[model samples]
Target: MQITPDTLATLNNGFNAAFLQGFNAIGSQGNQYQQVCMEVSSSHRLENYGWMKDLPGVREWIGPRLINNLEATGYQIVNKDWEHTLGIKRPDIEDDILGVFTLAVQQQGDIVGRHPNELVFAQTLLKGFTTTGFDGQYFFDTDHIGYDVNGAETSWSNAGGGSGSPWFLLDLSRTFMRPLVFQMRRAPEFTPLVSPSDPNVFHMNEFLYGVYARYAAGFGFHQLAYGSKQTLDAAAYAAARTALGTQYRPDGSALAVRGTHLVVGPGNEAAARRILLAERDAAGATNIWQGTAEPLIVPQLG
Candidate 1:
């Protein structure tokens, strides 16, 4: 499939995050350096394009790109220069560097999906090898099943799945265990604080305090686009409440929580706060804690 500029940018961003995380994780293991490099180099050669096959230098181009991206993202380089980073002396024998690269690419795929822009670029590099019938699938000897009904390897046929489908097939060897579900009771006195006259306040209050509310409901919180603060606050509050497991009855149907507060006009923080304070006092929520105005707290999963 053809890649668009936006898709490419998303791929790059995702790859950068994945690569940094992988590099940090593996590079911390001191003794497995050479093995790491070999795995990376082999994987890259298998997956990457032909121009990279036998470049005179020990360092691969993608290696530097991955490293640079990681470093830019505030990750510290655990190993020194690649030539001596893994305690290896021989140029041909060093595999730790390659190992790092391989881990980075795999992690990137997991986070951003397989067809990331970086993967696309790497595949494009493979065009030179493809001219010589060098398809990447055989670079690693995965397995060899016999021909299918069409006398072609079953592997060559369409798998009847699209992007995001699992490539391998295997059944779990044991029974899967299920987790316990906890049912929470609705608060008796809880009432929505938003009013129609100052809808911006509702959206803003939600944007500000809905973070904790969303977490209570079991979904993650994110920032709302800037607009009418009062309306946004009202909506945000309702959204956050719903996220926190509060059921809202509308036409006798319970709506699944979708956590985003829509605003009607330009958002004003000052006006939003004024409306929120008046509503909070009216609702008799004496324990309300006020903090410096900020859009959504930084999510800490832990």
Candidate 2:
């Protein structure tokens, strides 16, 4: 059934109700966290077991070494220590969905039927939030590899997700991550808006949120940019290209890192596109930067 006004109200009202008070503690007093969009290499992924897989340090098996073991002789891994083999523990971001409702209400003459604006407004909220991961606070987190009881690693690369999931690539090796992976684990169960304080009243469902990236110190400082200028230019594009070229992988080999996507806020989309999609070089005589990357308009970045 379609989401109705009452349903939207249910979700909205619940959101207005009890928020995760404790979760609010994040990014409130401590040092502010910044989400830097960098390139990440899919070649660096290793399906090692445990929380170690999510840890930045464990990603050292990049390049051709990752799957080369299977191609070689007698390649059978044997690790049967299940007594203390902990399950893949994802960061505690909660994904609480409001209860489903019926759109089955037929419009009786002149009653105006379901509120026409309700679904639209609801859609607005969702669309507004779709690219909001660029902002701070408990938002969508990247998924980690799950493991079996025998401590064997499970593939996250299913038709359902895994490799099909969105990610970036760093020209660098596996030891270093170019694009910071937003590790997350959505809550397995959901609670409909129900009142525990008082059974008669509907309570907002709990939407828990928590996300963590690696140490900010890991970020390559020189790679950051903010010229003493106002608008995008070929010089700026050239600098970005040069910086992206420095991304390295775990094998200590240089990766083919290219910006490929110049994501910008709605306000900056035009300017960013002008630099990236220009038919002629914004700086040099050639159209070098043109088509090197597309301008991704993410209004939320604003």
Candidate 3:
């Protein structure tokens, strides 16, 4: 993405607010939270992923992304930064100590408040716009979507090659999961402390907050063009064009998929511009998807 003033302005204005809310919901530990943590025993796993070996068509199911709870807390503090400033300060100055205590309370909120942001960003950085086959795919209904008819490792796809992307027809819109679901706790609220005589100390009550969110960031229901193949060339651009028409759910139904969002890494800025800003197609034909999709340049997508 461009680091120019205008580019940065666009990013600041159009950053992912949905994802942000999924990460941080302030004052929510009492009743609202972005996500929650669910314990998984060795037997209780996060998800099941289907894979097939090229060697002998050996199929197997593997573990998918796991959710864990992390603890974040605000610190307790009471400060007398200007205790000796009685003459240097006003006589009826209780707001200084109380004000510092109030600020400390805000810090406490930030401590646990930022974990969801950190976790979500890390996950996105790791798997945004991936092209592998269900490498980290998670599904609400493993029985339907995540499950495949590979004969359970005893079965294999004899259809020439493994399944590629969905081959959907036009106008039939496909339904997709809302991307992420964060389960969180509303533990309690923060309380402050103040002593009348000893106005030097500020304190915040102890509390905890966390989430167990599911992140599914695979590229559509199937893979199209990605990796080095996604240059701004004819084939690469065709893959994107194809996705507009070819996207779908697993049931062989058309999603009538129309994408207005464009996700690209910093490296793809030039290429992305070439594709998104084209007045015509590569052969000077009428651009079909042009002016419809807006680019969301993400450095983490690199």
Candidate 4:
């Protein structure tokens, strides 16, 4: 089958449903948790369980499978060496060795060629802000002593002012493996218009407000725009502290907030880094500003 934008969309929808089912199943089973610390490398000649071979059982499999599904829809994967393990220390080890993997997917141009419908959806979502105005009557000053002014002056403002439209930029270089990187312009348009309490807007809020979250969930990768490790680490620490609170206790504890963790599975190292970094920042770690990691691509698949 020739993978095109329409096909990719269909594939993505199916993939998401399937992926969620798999994740929920794994979560309920409790068997996946034990696999986290399993050794990827050989322990010794005598201790040869070959845990690496059981990749399907680990959480990492989620990412790879998603990527494969995207590929099946015609997206090419970009190949890059992303640092999987960092600051990791084994009891007697000195220097930390990193593990790497090559991702698979098609490029954006290729996606456009094959899946133009998908590209259209992406572009439409990527376009500039939608306009809305506040009524002058709503802004009238009650204390004003006007001759016979019925209401206050109304004005139209760019809802998504200062911040541009929310867009998902693709990393052109990592076309095959990591094809999509979303750029959410922090604009009014991006903000949820409906009040959380309003029943009429509840569903709207749930759908529109979820663009970023859905994007993050859909794409199994993140990007750290701020280049330096220290900046990233600092941001991570601060977020963790804020979420957990200064005083740690067994009870009344908040959710743990930390920097991004690798999407344990396979494919496209650079894209993985982007995904992790994005997740870390999205979780409220803003000290490390997203910088020149421009057009970061996120693979549509796992």
Candidate 5:
């Protein structure tokens, strides 16, 4: 193809089409982050998660309605820039070997499409033991503070203490909130720098293409997720579920969180499947825990 305006435009259009094709293909089928994290749009470089605290439940109407204020928790998620670039040597297009470059660009789109899974599962959830949530405590901690029925400061936990491969039990029943946040400042855009006059095109003798995106992942409500490094056995799974269900709100009421998904790494996929799918246990006893929660195996977690 000649390096004319029309040809450059045509090349970009074709590459963009391929990019979308690849993106849509994987975005719909391979994304697991949406199962655990809620996507929230960000208009600025950083978003303050100050409103994560629970509000007081409605009480009997007193002389004046109790005005509960949402105090800032100082938890924030900052959107970070991300990009994946692919350079096609000028000779490739001139030689009509553009098919390979098209696939390469499409692959870049696939990478962008799956990036949220990396941020949520690989980075955030995998490191949840050390990562702080909105409550200014590690997302999965034993001493998460809450209030009791008497308005007394009480401690609750979302972590099951054990020294083994980490697994998570997430309460995704809430529609408006989740245990994790996916903050998107900008959707991915695929752009090309193929103009003949462009310095990079002239000097590098290649056409540059890239996908740019701005996003970040952070912990949301700690009550919605429980992480256990304990060997993912029947006892551990049951314990985690019980802990999540017994969480209380700051207003000293039942938060009523329930574990809806069982997240595990490749290392524990077999055990997780046995626990959730098997109709009978290893002892030939009925699998009472069957269908408790759906099993999600995240490759990145391994």
Candidate 6:
């Protein structure tokens, strides 16, 4: 192939196609964040999430309807610009070694597709202990205050105190609401700067392939998740489940947050599998905790 106007356009289109192919493939298969996070489309640079914790329970209508003031303030998730770029030297294209660059661009797309997983697991989950949620407390804290159904102030916990490898138990039954929020202002877009007159191409003597998006991840409902740093064993797992199941709504009603998924890093994969999959325990006794929750082994958490 010769360096011509027509050929440059063709190359750009080809790379874009490759990127889309790679993106669609991994985006469907490799994404795990979607299973745990409630994806919210963002139309602005930031979104207020204070209303997320306004758990208003349905009440019996007698004479007049009770109005639960849901005017919450303060909690917000600000979208941030994220990008990835790949450079293809002119010499590589001239030598017809386009295969490597094509794969690289595809891998770039793979990265784009997996970006949410990184944000949710690597960044948000790992930082939950320190990060504040809508209630102005750590997402995984021992002193989360709320009003019970009886209009009494109550304090509940979603964290198990320990100093070991961290693991999580989450209630994924609520599709519209989740333990975490993935706010997307823009989906990743692939752009190729292959025009010969472009400054980057002219000065650097290389074509630039870039992927850009705007998004943010935040804690949604603390009651929907429980994080523990204790040892991953039957005792600890059972305790975590009890904590999640006993959560109460602000209206003082039972939240009924079941532990649907047990999330752990690679370090706890075997233990998690044993707790959720093994039919029998190491003592050769029936494992009562078997089939309790699906185990999710996230590499990012490792």
User: Which candidate wins on lDDT?
Assistant: 6
Model 3, TM vs. native: 0.37
Candidate 5's residue-wise lDDT over 38-122, tens digit each? 8899999999989888776767897988888889989999999999988888888888898788888788878889888988888
Q: lDDT per residue, candidate 1, 12-48, as tens digits? A: 3543454445434433222111110111112111132
Model 6, CA-based lDDT: 0.88
RMSD of 4: 27.4
What are the per-residue Cα lDDT tens digits for candidate 6 across 71-184? Answer: 775899999999999988887887888988889888888888888899999999889999988888999999988556575777878889898889999999999989999999
Model 6, position 140: C-alpha lDDT score: 95
Instruction: Report the lDDT tens digits of candidate 4 across residue range 1-302.
Output: 23345643553454334333432343312322111111122222222111111011123454444321111222111221111111112211112121210011112112212221222223321221231101111111122111112222222111112332122222223222221222212211112222335453344322111111111101211111001111223343333223222221122232122222221112334443553345454466552533323322222211
Collision count of model 1:
34
Q: How displaced is residue 165 in candidate 1, in Å?
A: 34
CA error at residue 7 for candidate 3, angstroms: 46
- Shift in Å, residue 207, candidate 3: 14
Q: After superposition, how far is residue 52 of candidate 3 from its true place, in Å?
A: 21
lDDT tens digits, residues 146-206, model 2? 2333334442211111221121212223333333331112211122322224332323333
The positional error of residue 206 in candidate 6, measured at the CA in angstroms, is 1.0
- What is the TM-score of candidate 2? 0.34
Deviation of model 6 at 196, angstroms: 1.4
Quote each prediction's TM-score. 0.16, 0.34, 0.37, 0.15, 0.96, 0.96
Better of 2 and 4 by lDDT: 2
lDDT of 3 by residue, 190-246 (tens): 221222232333222211121222322222223222222224444454555553444
After superposition on all CA atoms, what RMSD does each candidate show versus the true structure? 30.0, 18.8, 16.7, 27.4, 1.4, 1.5
lDDT score for candidate 2 against the true structure = 0.30
